[model samples]
Target: MTDQRAPLIQRGIVDLMIAADRLRFQIEAALRPMGINLTQMSLLNHFSWQPDRAQSITELTDVMAINQPGVTKAIAALADRGLVEKIDDAEDARVKRVKITPAGLEALGQARQAAWPPVEAAFGSLDDEELAAFTSHLVKMKASLAIS
Candidate 1:
């Protein structure tokens, strides 16, 4: 004889997957009109956030938790679209650094402005304390999961 009643256990990865899917859907919807996908937007955002830092495809792979080939493909596409430019690394000519162009910056700014209002509205019902607590918990979870 065995006990048949047991509660289903949900892991952090399951929650993360759901959240990531939702975020991707929202971002894709926001970026569709601009002819950009989530991957391109993410790269652009990274460049905007760290203007001084020179990021390579490999670096982007690690930061984005994606593969090198995918990042390379995205970079090539963005370059073709004139949204990003590849510059030779000063110290290592063999290495290429990615930088966002003026057009890319403008696009990113517009996308951020347009997307933030809706996202803010969704979360705005929460009080400041609740928001802070949620943020803190999320940060801890991310740290625990070793998600950069």
Candidate 2:
């Protein structure tokens, strides 16, 4: 039974991975004209979802699942582009928090607009019911992995 299930399990995982990679490529292509890459747009999206549009380097590292140096580098790049600013934490002077500027939000909104068409295209074949079921299954898988 285990041997029989192995192929099914492997195929399922591979299909998901390939789908994700293709979607990522499409999104990246969509974002290219806006002078933003996937990782930068992802960071901007994360900040937009935050209450204060701000987070510490450590927090960003944890959420992005990247190393400290990488987070710092991305933050610096955003800062240089005037999309985000690093501020001294109110309570902890030693900790610097990165906050999105108004321009950052504007860019994020534009990025979303640019990104939506490809995403919609990807799902356009699915009817409403099918889309909902697909999304529900994805949510369940995310939950199973304890991902938010």
Q: Please report the candidate that would top lDDT against the real structure.
A: 2
lDDT of 1 by residue, 1-148 (tens): 2434322224555766786788668867877887788888888898988666768887889888878988999899889988889989989889999888888888888888766765776578899999999889889877887845
The global Cα lDDT (0 to 1) of model 1 is 0.81
Candidate 1 lDDT score at position 48: 89
Identify the candidate with maximal TM-score: 2
lDDT of each: 0.81, 0.88
Worst 10 residues of 1 by lDDT: 1-10
Question: After superposition on all CA atoms, what RMSD does each candidate show versus the true structure?
Answer: 4.0, 2.2
**What are the clash counts of all predictions, listed in order?**
0, 0
- lDDT for 43 in candidate 2 is 88
Model 2: worst 10 consecutive residues (lDDT sum)? 45-54
**Residue-wise C-alpha lDDT for candidate 2, range 8-29, written one tens digit per residue:** 9899999989988999999999
Q: Which stretches of candidate 2 lie over 4 Å from their true place?
A: 1-4, 51-53
